[model samples]
Target: MERVVITGMGAVTPIGNDVKTYMDALKAGKCGVAPITHFDTAEFKVKVAAEIKDFDPTQYMDKREAKRMDSFCHYAVAAAAQALEQAGLREPGSFDPWRTGIIFGSGCGGLPIVETEVVRLHEKGPSRVSPLYIPEMIANMAAAHISMQFGIRGESVCPITACATSTHALGEAMRMIRHGYQDIVVAGGTEAAICTIGMAGFQNMKALYTGDDPQAASIPFDKRRSGFVMGEGAGALILESLSHAKARGAHIICEIAGYGATSDAYHITSPDPEGEGACRAMQLAIADAGLTPADVDYINAHGTSTPINEKYETIAIKKAFGDALKSVKVSSTKSMTGHMLGAAGAAEAIACAMAICDGIIPPTINFVEPDEDCDLDVCPNHAVQADVKVAISNSLGFGGHNATVLLKRYE
Candidate 1:
């Protein structure tokens, strides 16, 4: 199989808009949670979220183009453009257009737009709804827009796997390169689900944290954690085959060693108590990398701060690593960025790849009280300096989806 490597990364997260700002915020333990400003949350139980503040879409696209896209697509395009810029491959003449592709993912495509359009239909009748409603609301448009923007004519796909959506996209992109389907792929996930209907849906399910304090609301792996704090953003990466990247003299950030995906088939929203599916996913990823558990130095946990999620994820880690569990340093960036839903795994995967390159493991902030179940070293409350040669990022989603991606420091 051909080796795949990551050349560039871009992120539009709650804590920061670009990769540098995001990494800086992570190293500084800056939390992005605040009172929900996108809508009126007075009637809703959940009052807070991690929103991208003061976002100006015009900075990334023309005013007309910006107006046509949903906010989620705006995020996706901005992040994708940033990634392409960092890769220094945005020019049409730089690479064969047919050899480049894209794989983007989103959980709830354009809920905010759908909510408003549905209201327009109810109050002002069907004719009032915009003609672009379906095009803007579809989950695949994120990838479609990226393909159009960059003139990539190869395989373009959008995978929707709830929270694990982006990780699955990244893993599939890696396989696409390894399998000789394409030489370069722009891959990642995006989300914008912090609107009125979106919040009410999660609130009704009791999935969101109703805590008053923004800084302390997203406390992962802590005894007092009640629920996850919702967040919205996009994360993107430029992945290319090793031969292709070197031929173009791309600055390789890291090597994508392996990927694994599984389904629990146990619950629609809740994870399996034993974490059997998650364990299998991790084991498979490790084996695919031709490595044992001991070779992994760090793990970016899918710690959503939900009670069941944290507990079972710990069980999965123990089962997957066994005796090597104690040696791995784990942390949840969601503690700072809140739960980014579909984009969570993709954003954290970038953080893990950056860790391999920079030798710094981002911390799980807001961790106060410890729990016996989550007993691993979670790099709690502070970023740590370490030699992170090999790292794995875990993303578990609703509907029993589990995915893991492994990255190794480029030598």
Candidate 2:
């Protein structure tokens, strides 16, 4: 198999717009959670979210172009542009466009646009609905828009596996590069679902944190954890074949060693009670990398700050690694960025790459009290500096969808 290496990364997260800003805020233990300002939350039970502050889409796109596309697509395009720039692939025409591809993920694609169109149709009749509604609301538009923007005609696709969307997208993109199907692929996830209907749906499901205090709202692995704090953003990474990267003298961030995906087939909204599915995914990723559990030094956990998820994920880690779990430094960057839904895994993957490159582990902030069931050493409160050779990022989405990606420090 051809080797796959990550050459670039870009993020438009709630905490920061770029990787440097994001990493700085994370290391400073800052929390992005605040009362929802995108829309009035007067009638909703959940009012807090980690929103992308001061993000003006017009900055990255023209007004006419921005009007036709939904916020989700705008985020995806902007992130992809950043990733491509960082990868030093500024001129798409210079490369074989046919051999490049795009695989972006979206869990709720253009949800706010759909909600708006639905209200317009009901209140102002069908004629009032925008003609671009269908194209804007589809889940695949993010990937489609990215392909169009970058002139990538090969294997344009989107993975919409709820929260696991981006992990699967990256994994699939890696597979394509590894199999000699593509030399370069723009892969990651984007989400902008912090609207009235989106918030109401998750609020009704009791999946959002309701704490009035922003700092205390997203306490993953803590005894006082209630639920995840919804966040909105996008993360994009540039994956290139190892030979292509070396030929271009591109700076390699890390190598995409293995990817594992599984389904619990157990529930629609909750993970497997025993974390069997998650354990299987991790084990598969480790085995695929030809590494033992002891080889993994850090884990960017799918710790959404929910009681059940934290408990079950802990069980899964213990089951997969046994005594090796004690030596692993696990942290939930979600504690700072909140949960980016479908984009969560992609954002966390960037954290993993950054960790391996900088030798610093981001912290799980606001971890006041530990849950008995979650007894692992969750690097809490502050970042830590340590030599990391290998790291794993895990994302578990609704419908029991689980995905894991193993990344190794570039030699």
Candidate 3:
């Protein structure tokens, strides 16, 4: 197999819209959580979320074009534009259009649009629904729009595996490049589900934080931790074949070493009790990289700030690393960014790359009290400065999907 490397990254997160801003927030340990402003949440039990603030889609796209797309697609297009620009990929003429591809992931595709259309059809009439509803609401439309905007004629697909969506999408894109199926691929995830229906659904399931304090609302692995705070954002990475990048003298962020995906087959909405599936996924990723668990120096954990998730993830880490668990520096960026669901894995992967490149581990902020079961070092509160050689990112989704990707610092 050929090698794959990350050439560029872009993010439209709750904390920031660009890599520099996002990394700055991470270093400062800033929390992005705030009261829901997208819609009034007076009747909802969970009233807070990490919504992307001050986003004006018209700044990134034509106002008329933006009107036809959903928020998720808009976010994806903005992020993709940034990633392509950062990678020095200007137009289809710069590269073979047939050799360029787009693979994006979305856990809930155009949820806000779907909710709006449904409400319109019910309250008004079917004729009142916009004709662009279906195109904007489909999960694959994010990838489709990105392809159209960039004039990419290669494979375009969107993976919808809940929270693990982006991880799988990135991994699959990496595989395509490694196998010579594509020379370059824009891979990542986007999510903008911060709407009334989205918030109410998660609130009814008790999957969101009800804490009044935004700072303490997303304390992963802490005794005070409640549930995840809903977040909306998009993250995109430009993956190129090693030869292609080398030919262009691209700045390589890191090398994609391995990727592993699995399913618990045990639950629809919860992880396996023992975290066996998660453990296996990480272990397989390590093995696929031709490295032992001890070779991993850092982990961007899927710490969602949920009680059961935190416990099971801890168990999974211990099962995979054994005694090496103590040697690894683990962190949950979600503590500050909240849970972006499908976009999380890609965002976390970017965090891992940033950690490896900058030699500073992002902190799991607001981690005051720790559970006995979660005894591992979480690099709490403050960022930790360390030389990270190899890093792994974990993303476990609802419906038992678990995905892990291993990345090594570019030498």
| Candidate 1 regions with alpha-carbon error over 4 angstroms | none
Clashing pairs in 2: none
Q: For residue 102, what is the lDDT in candidate 2?
A: 90
lDDT of 3 at 186: 96
User: In candidate 2, residue 66 scores what lDDT?
Assistant: 90
> Please, what is the whole-model Cα lDDT of each candidate in the order they appear?
0.93, 0.91, 0.91
* Stretches > 4 Å off in candidate 3: none
lDDT of 1 by residue, 132-232 (tens): 99999999999998988888899999999999999999999999999999999999999999999999999889988987798779999999999999999
The positional error of residue 101 in candidate 3, measured at the CA in angstroms, is 1.0
Q: Give model 2's TM-score versus the native structure.
A: 0.99
> What's the CA RMSD of model 2 in angstroms?
0.9
Backbone clash pairs for candidate 3 read none
Each candidate's clash count: 0, 0, 0
The CA-based lDDT of model 3 is what? 0.91
The candidate scoring highest on TM-score is 1
* Two-way lDDT contest, 1 vs 2, winner: 1
RMSD of each: 0.7, 0.9, 0.9
* Per-residue alpha-carbon lDDT of candidate 3 for residues 107-128, written as tens digits (9 for 90 to 100): 9999999998999999999999
lDDT per residue (tens digit) for residues 54-108 in model 2 = 7777767788889999888888888888888889986856568888899898999
